[model samples]
Target: MSKVDFDEYVKEYDELLNKNLSFFSKDDSYFCRYKADLIKQYSSKNPKRILEFGAGIGRNIPFIKNAYPESEIYAYDVSQKSLDYLEQKHPYAKVIREFKGFENFFDLVFCSVVYHHIPVDERQKATNDIFSSLISGGEFFVFEHNPLNPVTRKLVERCPYDEDAVLLSPGEMKNTAKAAGFNDFSVKYYLYFPPALKISFLEKFLRTLPLGGQYMLKAIKR
Candidate 1:
């Protein structure tokens, strides 16, 4: 699907996902807190330029902005509705046109929950786009579904993602990041509580543990 249409679908879907995607969002939600922590850990060095691909409803922007208030934040998506919402939520943001060529323009590029939507043939191109856009020594942080989790794998198939969309095993995630020209790659699994309990206490407690239900990958461009 075109990015514009994809964005539109999510604008209508954000609420549904917020309620349904329990493993990813509980209390502060994995993405919210993860982005915040990422900002705290990495933004201190002050990356002046940032870009977010498939930034659905602009959820990560507020937290990311907290750390880099002065940095220019660029959001890109295919959905006009979602982009409209993003623009409304983040007036300071600049919406990037499609295929803007991210080469060496961003110190940090955030792509969350998007790879799975790409077709198989396009997955490498997407990775290449991310790689080409990052500056040498830049960082790309991805938080994706773990195929190792049987439940997650099944849920992904049911989701409105492209057929090529597949969950990534820890090793697969690391290897893909490396192939994308990112080094010092690390993958951490998260979200390991029963979905019945949608509270932050469990998430906070579970996050302290090394293994969880979901997975996050941190890769640095070298």
Candidate 2:
């Protein structure tokens, strides 16, 4: 297969994402809220700076902003168009095309559902970039589709923009983090029930199950 042109792919996805932003709204689903909660729990107290890697259209902006209210938030993505939309929607965030001058600049970095779209060979470089973006002992929260979940598989198959997506298992994510030179990290499985079937009382119990639609890898930079 030919190498996927991520720059072009991102631009196309930016347009699609803008129109579908409501689907990712935090208030619309427990999944979004739960992911945000995880981010809030793992990040440092009063983080000085935060970066949201692959923050397409800034869907996680509200959650990150609320989580680190006192911190300077930066948004990074491959698409300028997506960053443009994110900037207009979130004027306070500093949008960047690359992590060029940001080595060791952030206390926390949140990456959500963006890695599966990355080509396998390029993931190492992406992981290393994220590792470099954070200061020593900083936190990196990575969320991705759980390949073990049937629903997740179906959703990825049905989504038009996800044509190139290759879901990563929790083990794959953990290995990527470890290969990036991070020895301190833990993987957590979450979101067992979809919004329509979600029962609030059972969420805590269900979170222990590894059959959720997605999983998160929380790594600390050394």
Candidate 3:
């Protein structure tokens, strides 16, 4: 797949979101709830500093802010337009294009649905940058589309911005983290059923199954 100019896509990003509001809302709500639970469960101590990698338009800011009210949140993206919107919408977050001066600074870094947009050849370098930005034992959370899921694949096919996306499987995400020198890692498959069909009990068991619409990989910097 060819690399995409994300800056160009940021112009129509909100339009696309409006068009697919229903579809996007379901995934967003599900992930936000899931992330809240995951953070409470995984975090050993209160995170004082947090980074959102590829934080386009700051979609994850609200959830992260509410989850960790005391944390200083920062957003990073390649699109100035997106960063502008994010800064306007979320004044609490500091936006940046480069990771300079942030080595071993963040206690946690969260990335969602961004890796697929990155070209395959550059993924390792991107992961390394993320790894370097984290403090030792700090956690990195990555959420990505599950290519094996038919629903996920179909949704990506219909989304215009996803044209340049090259979906990565769970194994690929683990390899990316490992290549970046992260040793303690874990992966969870989630969102087995859409919002309408969501069953709490069933979802619990389904997490073990890799057929969910999306998967999350957590790696701790060692």
Candidate 4:
């Protein structure tokens, strides 16, 4: 979308995400629990630094900061309004420009539901930038929407969502990571239902299966 729409969306995204967070938090859906676990798994408890790209509104800051209270947390986003909100919420985080030369600088770098906002063509360049920012052997974690989900595909296209959003398949994500100078890349599916759905048992069962509606891809810097 245009800059105006991006700004407007940022102004309103909290309401939308807050609703989902509330719904998902009621029963600790596997996705919710799984996301936290994934972050912990990638983040070293005694990390000296952390970087989060596309960290709109600092949604993951609280948990990340809690997990590594002594580490410095740096974030970057293109939206000024979103960064404003992030600064308000997480004064401790240092906001940078786009993801450039982030490689080998952080012990763990992550993004949540954010990579989709990257254009399909430029996604690789973005991944390269993310890779450049990481420290050797540092892990990268991404919580992304699954493109194979018919329901999600319909809604994302139907809405006046960010124009840059491009859902990618599991294999596509792995390839992008591999092309970005990463090794040991892998994608793990999770979140088996629509955000509005309210069935934890069903979510858990769905996640246990081979296919799910979302995923968390973990990779290491080579």
Candidate 5:
């Protein structure tokens, strides 16, 4: 199997996602909103410009837009069809179909479960590109599936669109950020509860646990 052709999955993406990964929040928009919310939570200030790296069909666009309604919002993706569809749905965002280093342009860059799709050999360049795209104090927020979790591993192995996914551990994620010149890094494991579990309150107390279904890494450019 090769990398996923996201264009083919654009229309059915939401249905497929919720059907499989609603364990995060048991909400129709959990996967998308969850990440967008995380970005907002960690942001030090209201960023003047925001970019969604690998935006794919713009499922996360609306939430990000709402979070930074006064800020400029931009989305980038390799799939032209997905970009086109996303643009139609979200004319507010400037959609980039091709890759160009924004070059110290974004105040914040957010990626949600995207790096696993990059070829293992190219992840270094991707990180470096992101470093170049952010300002001196810009922040990068990354969310990735936890390879250490059996259920997350099973989900990735079975996901059709995840054919190219190479799950990186928290340490690998940290090293990639460090090599890219990102400092003041903070890593936390989350999604510790299953679907509709009332123990959501306990998640904050368990950030150090590695058994969570997913993990988030926050890197700041200094």
Candidate 6:
């Protein structure tokens, strides 16, 4: 699949995303805050520096800031336009287009639904780069759509930016991180029910099920 240039979609990014995912939540921040909440609940480390990998358009910026207001936050993406939008919207986040002199720099690296957009062959190299950037014992939090879930598959099929998406399984995520030298890997499925069918209490019990619309993978650089 040919890579989609995100720069072209920076203008209509939010609209297009909402068109597809609005069913889950009318407010876009609902999805963004979910990741931040997961981080806060699962993480044991008080990172001095946090990195938002593939932070396109920075929807998560405010929530991340809310979660760690004092920690220095850095945003990185291949799309300059997306980075520009992120910078303009959230001045607190320092944006960078390239990874240079950043090894062992970040205490936590976060990625959300970004891996599917990456070309399959390049994923290993990208994972390796993330591994190299994190400080020893730093955590990497990655969230991705689970292709096993029919709803997620349909959403990806309908979204324009996801035209080239190749969804990865939970096993693939664990193995890829392992190959990149990540240890203590853990993964939990999410979005088990849509807005209407969702039962808050039962949701936690369903996290181990692999049929959720999405999954979160946590790994550490040990």
Task: Name the top lDDT candidate.
Answer: 6
Candidate 2's TM-score: 0.86
As for model 6, its CA RMSD to the true structure in angstroms is: 1.2
Weakest lDDT window of 10 consecutive positions for candidate 6: 192-201
Candidate 2 local lDDT, 77-146, one digit each (tens): 8867778788998999999886686688888888898898788989999999888888898888999988
lDDT of 4 by residue, 1-222 (tens): 532245567766755545444443443333444676667765544568888788777767777777678889988887777888888888999988565545478877887777788777778988888888787878888888777776556556655654557777767888999999888866667766545555644654454354665777888886
| Full candidate order by lDDT, most accurate first | 6, 5, 3, 2, 4, 1
lDDT of 5: 0.86
RMSD of each: 3.7, 3.2, 2.1, 3.5, 1.5, 1.2
How close to the true structure is residue 110 of candidate 2, measured as C-alpha lDDT? 81
Candidate 4: residue 65 lDDT (0-100): 77
Better model by lDDT: candidate 1 vs candidate 4: 4
Better of 4 and 5 by lDDT: 5
Per-candidate Cα lDDT values, in order, are: 0.69, 0.77, 0.82, 0.71, 0.86, 0.90
Error of 6 at 172 (Å): 0.8
What's the ranking of the predictions by TM-score, best on top?
A: 6, 5, 3, 2, 4, 1
lDDT, candidate 6, 105-139, per-residue tens: 89999999999998989899899999999999999
The residue pairs that clash in candidate 6, if any, are none
lDDT (10s digit) by residue, model 1, range 1-222: 443246446545765565557554455455566655744564434678888887877888877777678989888876677778888889988887585656788888877777666654666667778889988877777777767677676676666533446556667667776776778876656666654565544555454354565666778887
C-alpha TM-score for every candidate? 0.79, 0.86, 0.90, 0.81, 0.94, 0.97
Better of 2 and 6 by lDDT: 6
The top-ranked prediction according to TM-score is: 6
lDDT of 4: 0.71
Question: Over all chains combined, what TM-score does candidate 6 have?
Answer: 0.97
Model 2 backbone overlap count:
0
